[model samples]
Target: METKARLVAAAREPLWERGYAATSPRAVLDATGAGQGSMYHHFRGKEDLARAAVDLNTDEMRAQVDTDLGGPGPALDRLHRYLRRERDVLRGCRFGGLAQDPEAMASPVLAPRVEEMFRWPVGRLAPVVREAQAACELRPGLDADRLAVAIAAGVQGGYVLARATRDPTVFDSAVDGIVALLDTARTEP
Candidate 1:
């Protein structure tokens, strides 16, 4: 890999694993076997480099969501596929974990990236929820945007619950519970 790419690749796992506050410049440099000068040459500093890493991770996440949400099915099925997709539940979400970091959350420079990362799922799912409503798979009274936000919130909240309990099944149960509630909205006589 190119030096800049290598640096970013090295930094991503540590940032995800340790969160922004705990991930240090030296650890990132050590991961890439690059020196301080090399990192500085490519990035303004640790936070700048972290921004790039988070951006990279967000791109990957978008691709994964597209795979699940864009799959062939009724809109609800696609949304279910998204909610049921494999995840490292106890590891928590990288963006969510980063947002939890006081250092990242406190900074205007960093918080927006974390915020935007979360906004993607809600935005992407809104149309799918609307389609389901139009098909009467969802009740007509349901607000598409709010339902989309709820779905995204469930996934993120699942991670938090699983992490807190140190139990992956807690994540599964939360997801299954949300899906069950969505099922209740199905329009049928």
Candidate 2:
């Protein structure tokens, strides 16, 4: 890995563990074994470094979601595959965890990037939901966008509930519950 990439990887856990507010530039440097001058040359500062990290995380997330949402299936199946995809259930959502920090939430640069990560998944799922409704796979009253947001929130909520309980089962249950709701049977005459 390049020095910058190494720096980003080293920073990921600390930022996820300590959050942007508690995390320091020096911590990233120490974690990566990069000198201050080198780190600065690669990034403007901590905020710039954080933006890079968020971008990396977001891209990875988008790719994983695409794998689930872009695959062949009914809408409910696609959404189920997405919700039930293997996850570090105990660790929580990377971007969501960061956004919970007061400093990260306040950061103009970091906040938007973190928020965008969540928004991307919701947006991607909305189209799939609309298609499902068009195919009559979903109830007539289903709101595609709202349902997408709710699904996103359920995943976020799963992370929170899991982390709070320090167990993975809570997260799994949350995911299953969301999937079950999405899989609700359509009314057939």
Candidate 3:
């Protein structure tokens, strides 16, 4: 059981680094330091094991966002915390990056997992945006749902910009630009 868990954890980094189509089962085995016999014993094959790793990866991503956004604080402050938290910028978002992959996008099996990864955050973010608006931290008449979508876009799009330019600052600048736009929406006393 522990060995299987270890295998999933090992597979996760490679999947995030290289996406589903590129990473090999042998690489996963090497990462976990487990033998082929053990891999087969633990999983049907690479796809089955990759599913486990992807599931774990997506769950972990959700928990982090839930904690940062759901934690008690001023609503906009929570948004700021989420956007400003240090990330492996050049590596990009594990979930968002997967969504862009040709193979992953084409696969019915993989595509929904990627969609859930985006949907969960945007759904969670809506309430936070509503809270910010209620607190007058955001301007009235703005649609919280749209704002939440924008926020998600900013983060995911930041990853795109960073990866394209091979510069982490591109990601940070995207985040900062979104933050500034939100700031402009702040109500004056």
Candidate 4:
């Protein structure tokens, strides 16, 4: 890859795994075998590179979610697929994990992007939930927006739980638990 692309790609893993505070420009340069000059050429600084890396991560995640929720099926099934989709549970969520980083969340550039990472999913899921409610798959009178937020919360919370307990199953249980709660909302037997 080119020097700029290499810097961004290298920055992504460390940013996700180590967060903004821990990931330094030198670390990125070391990872990419690019010189300080090359990095400076491509980015204003660590913050600029971090912004690029975060945006890339967010875009990729959003597309995956859109695919998962947009798949062919009953709306609930689509939601389930998203919840159960393959994830690096032990590594935690790239977007949600950033929320735990004081440095990342404090960044004027990163703060809103991280917030959108959480907010966008809730927005994406709300319509599908409404679709399920309309089709009688989910019980009536439930608030679609709130339910969407809950689902988003469940997934993020699951990551924290699993990380805290040092057990991936804790994550599975959280997600499965959300699915079960949703099932209880089914209009059908």
TM-score of each: 0.95, 0.94, 0.94, 0.97
Global lDDT of model 2: 0.86
Q: After superposition, how far is residue 181 of candidate 2 from its true place, in Å?
A: 1.3
Q: Identify the candidate with maximal TM-score.
A: 4
| Model with the higher lDDT, candidate 2 or 3 | 3
The 10-residue segment with the lowest total lDDT in model 2:
180-189
lDDT of 1: 0.90
In the range 62-105, model 2's lDDT, one tens digit per residue, is 88999999999887678788988999977778887787898998
The CA lDDT at 103 in model 4 is 91
Q: In model 3, which regions exceed 4 Å deviation?
A: none
Worst 10 residues of 4 by lDDT: 89-98
lDDT at residue 16 of model 4 (Cα atoms): 79
TM-score pick, better of 3 and 4:
4
Give the per-residue lDDT digits (tens) of candidate 1, residues 1-107. 88899989988887888888898889878878998999999999988998889889989999999999888989889989999999999999988889889999887
Give per-residue CA lDDT, model 4, range 1-189, as digits (tens). Answer: 899999999999888788889998888899889999998888889999999998889889989999999989999999999999989988899976678899989999999999988899999999999999999999989999999999999999999898888899999999999999999999976
Residue pairs in candidate 4 whose N, alpha carbon or C atoms collide under 3 angstroms: none
The model with the greatest lDDT is 4
* Pairs in steric clash, model 2: none
